[model samples]
Target: MSKTILITGASRGFGKLWADAFLQRGDKVIATARNLKDLQDLSDKYGQALLPLQLDVNDRAAVFAAVQKAQQHTGRIDVLINNAGYGLFGAVEETTEQEARAQMETNFFGLLWASQAVLPIMRAQGGGHIIQVSSILGLVTLPVLGLYNASKFAVEGLSETLATEVKQFGIHVTMIEPNGFTTDWAGASAASTTPMEEYAGLRKAFSDSATPDSFGNPAATTPAILKLVDSAQPPLRLLLGKVALPFAKSVYEARLAEWDQWQEVAHAAHG
Candidate 1:
């Protein structure tokens, strides 16, 4: 059955790809970005199947308003893809408090606001799925992007708890953790704070290794996401791409080692 799906940050990157994939599959899409004009081409092609809206996810009132408007048009939203966020690049020490908070507003708080606005709608509609566009950085980390990593880590925590909390309502929450994609993610979509000379070695390492497009094709993720939407029992987390799995495994492995090293000392405080 065709569903009403809402996609935030639909102007570019994974969000745009997901929008295209869903519309092609005959679903009704409400695609939003800060710049509604960016969606005009999609609107012209999809016509009534697409409703393009200007939405800034950080605005709590606007988030709720957009969801309400969407519900009025479709009567129910079956899926929500939260893809409205950007990567902030800088060493942790290099990032000013303002830059850090701005990073959180869009990456962390934005997701939180969208989820809050949609939950009641999903409940009233009897059930739905919320797909969070997280990253492999959520599971692990690197230099320069520490703030961005922190934001996605928050998303991982939020989505996991959301999954358990919303199960009774037939709602599903899946965090889509992808490694670097061949999208505008590394260029225009990413913001860098003031660079610290002290972190030049780390910056060079990041540049040489994790420069986004160096990963591979991002189109590979669309089908997996559709699978999640079609799933009768979707997992709490869906890691995408060739790099995603290995990266996740390594992170867990390291975490296990660290836990093993600290378990006795950590347990000592439990009393």
Candidate 2:
């Protein structure tokens, strides 16, 4: 059966691609972005199949109103993809408190609000799926991306817990951990904190390691997402991209090994 999906951040990047893919698959997509103009072409191309709505996920009222509109369109929202977020790169000490909070508001609380807005409707309709477009940073940290990593880590935790909480209602939660994709993810629009004079050396090191071009193609991960959407038993967590998959695997393995090596002490400490 074709599903009705509401995707946030549908203006560009993975969100735009996902919206298009869903439309191509005959699924109804309520594509949302901060600016409706950003989705004008898609709206023209897909017509009624793509309902472009302006939504700042951080706005609770806007999110609820958008959900109401989407529910009216299809009477049910089968999937809610929270793909609206951006990275803020800087050293921990160099990044301002406001900047860090702004990242969390969009990447973490934004998702929380959207999910909260949809839960009631999903409960009334019986079931739904929540797809969180997290990142490899959710599981592992890297230099210059502490703020982003924190936000994703928060999503990982919330999505995991929400999965169990909503299981009885038939709602499924999936966290997408994509490695660097050839999206405009690292573009100028994706802000970096004002470098602090005191942290110049660290900032330089971070810039040297983090570049916009260091990742896989966005198209490469789309098929995997489509497959999961079509599957009868989709995984709760999906690690996408060649770079992301290996990186996630290594992180999980290393953590496991560390745990095994310290299991006795861990048990003793917990007890």
Candidate 3:
């Protein structure tokens, strides 16, 4: 059976890739982008299967309005993919107030607004799925991506809480924690703070660690997404690329070891 899927940031990257995939498989996709023009090709190809709308996810009111319009179009949305965030690259101290706030606004608050907007509709329908496009940085840290890491970490916390809260309503929440993919995420879509001389070595080390295999092909993720949305039991979190799992495992193992080493000190604080 075909489902009605609403996706944000449908102009390009994973948003566009998944939208095209869903439409190809006969699902009704309500695609939202900041510039509606970016979706014209999809609209031309898919006809009624694609409903393109202009949206800036940072605008809370507009997000709610867009959700309402999408619900009216399909009567009930079976799934929502919140993929409307960008990367903010910088060292923690180098980040400006405006940049940090903007990162949270779109990446955290934007997802919050969209989640809130769809709740009433999904509740009325008795079920739905919400997929948040988080990153591997959400689980672990990387140098020179402090703001982006913080934003994704916020997404993880919010979405985890949301999953527990909405389980009773039969609304499933999943965070897609993708590692570096061959998308424009690190390219034109990324915003960077002015480089500080102190962080140059750190940046160089980070850049030097990259191998061609570190990034996955975005197109290859289609099947995983399709299966996730169609599943009777979807995971609370899904890692997209090959690198994510190993990276997460290493990070978490180290975290556990450190926590255990500090357990006595941590426990003493409670007294």
Candidate 4:
């Protein structure tokens, strides 16, 4: 059966790829972005299968309204893919409170709001799925991307807790940890706050290393995403790309080791 999937940030990158993939597979997609024009071409191409809408996930009221509208279009959303996020690259000290908060607003709170809005509809329908497009940085922190890393880390925790909480309601949550993809994630279109002058050297190095031109093609991960969407029992976490998989594994192993190393002392104190 064809499913109704609502995807945020559908204007570009993995979001656009996911929307196209789902449409190709005969799924009904309610594609949304801050600027609907970016999705206009897609809407023209896919017709009814792709319902394009303007959505700024950061706005709580807008998110609620959008989800309500989406539910009206499909009666129920079979899947909600929270793909709207931005990358903030800078050292912790270089990033301003406002900049960090803005990142959290879009990447963390935006996702939270969207999920909250959709949960009621899904619960009423008895089951649904939520896919969060997190990053490998969500699992591991790297230099110069502290703010981005923080957002993803928060998403990782939120998704994990949500998975457990929604299971009884027959709703599923999956977090996709993707590595570098050939998207405008680091080109002229990428989002970057003004870096502090003190860290100019580090920021320049990061910019050179993390540009979108250097990443692998985004098409590589679309298939995996479509597969996860269609699967009867998708895992709580889907690590995309070869690079992301190993990095995620390393993070998990290191976390486990650290926990194990502290377990004895932790338990002794409690006892």
Candidate 5:
């Protein structure tokens, strides 16, 4: 059976790769990018299997309208992939108010609107999958990229809550927590704050931590994602890169240890 999958940010990166894969496999794909021109190649290649829409995820009304149009086109949307987000690279102090709000508007609220828009359609259909493209940074912290981390963390929280709330409606939500990948996330798609001289050392350390091996190939993630979406019972959260699990484990362990060390205070606070 061919599924209807709607993906945001389909112009490039994982969204484009996944959209092509689905279309190749005979699924109906409604791909959205900020510019329809960017999706011209896919539209040309896939023909009717591809529905490319120009969308700025930051536009709330447009998101709802787009999703409604997609539902009308396919009759039903089997899956919705929220991949329209970018990274804001900077230390927290260096980030401006406008930059912070812009990050939340697109990365957080954009996703929220898309999810909200699809819920009614999926509910009427009795079942559907919603995949949120989050980051490992959502679960852990890193130097610089503070606003980006905050946005993803918000994504994680919202998706987790949504998963539990919608399970009864036969709606499944999965958060794809990927580590660094060979996407333009840190390049073309990224916004950066002005560099501060005081945090120069911290910035250098952050740069040094990212070796060539730290990033995964975007194309290589196809198999895992396919398996996930095809499963009878998919996980609420899926890590997309080799390093994501181990890094998350280490981070969680440290968090647990710190909590345990302050166990007395934690218990006392409840009093």
Candidate 6:
């Protein structure tokens, strides 16, 4: 069945690639971005199969309006892809209150508002899928990326809760945990704090670990993403990229080891 997939931040990066892939598969896409002009080319290529709308996920009101418009245009929203987010790089102490709040506003609250906007409609339609673009950072911490990590972690929690809450309504929520991807997400979309001498070593280490082209091509995950959307028994969490799976395993292993080491202390809390 051809689905009507509404994608935020559809102007570029993984979101843009998803839009193209969905269109290729003959699915309807309601592509959205802050600047509608960025989506004009997609509109031309896919014709009516693609609907471009202006949406700033940060604006709660705008999110509702965009969802309404999408439902109106397509008559159904089969999938709602919340992909409008950015990385804010900096150590915990290096970030300012305003910067941290802004990061949360877009990466966490923005996704929350969009999810809220779509739920009622999905209930009315009888079923839908909510795909959230999270990160491996959501499961494991990284130096110089505390703010971004916090945002993704919040997304992971919300998406998990949403899955359980909406399962009865036939709505599915999937959190996509992609490691470094060759997308503008690491380029133009990312914002870095003013470098401080205290965090210089951490910053240098981060850069050294991430070599040029170290990230996997975003398009390589397109097929997997589509399969996830099309699956009736979709997983609550889907990790993309070669490193994402192994890295997540390591994180869980380390976490379990800590639990085992402090099992007595953990039980004491409940006692």
TM-score versus the correct structure, for each prediction: 0.96, 0.92, 0.99, 0.91, 0.98, 0.97
Best by lDDT: 3
Pick by TM-score: 4 or 6, better one: 6
Shift of residue 145 alpha carbon in model 6, Å? 0.5
lDDT of 6 by residue, 1-271 (tens): 8999999988999999999999999999999999998988888898999999998888899899989989998899999999999999888888998999999999999999999999999999899999999999998988989999999999999989999999999999999999898888878999988888988887888889986555898889999988998999899989888888888888899999999999999899996
Question: What clash count does candidate 5 reach?
Answer: 0
What range of 10 consecutive residues in model 3 has the weakest lDDT sum?
87-96
Ranking by TM-score: 3, 5, 6, 1, 2, 4
Per-model RMSD to reference: 1.5, 2.1, 0.7, 2.3, 0.8, 1.2
Q: Model 3, stretches more than 4 Å misplaced?
A: none
Question: In candidate 5, what are the lDDT values of residues 1-271, reduced to their tens digit?
Answer: 8899999999999999999999898999999999899999998898998999999999999999999999999899999999999998889999999999999999999999999999999999999999999999999989898999999999999999999999999999999999999988899999999998999999999998889999999999999988888877999999888999999999999999999999999999998
List pairs with backbone clashes in candidate 5: none
- Residue 82 alpha-carbon offset, candidate 1, angstroms: 0.5
lDDT-better candidate, 5 vs 6: 5
Alpha carbon lDDT at 263, candidate 3: 100
**lDDT of the candidates, in the order given:** 0.89, 0.88, 0.95, 0.88, 0.94, 0.91
Kindly indicate the candidate among 4 and 6 with the higher lDDT.
6
> Using alpha carbons, what is the TM-score of model 2?
0.92
Give the Cα RMSD of candidate 6.
Answer: 1.2
Q: What is candidate 2's CA lDDT for residue 39?
A: 94
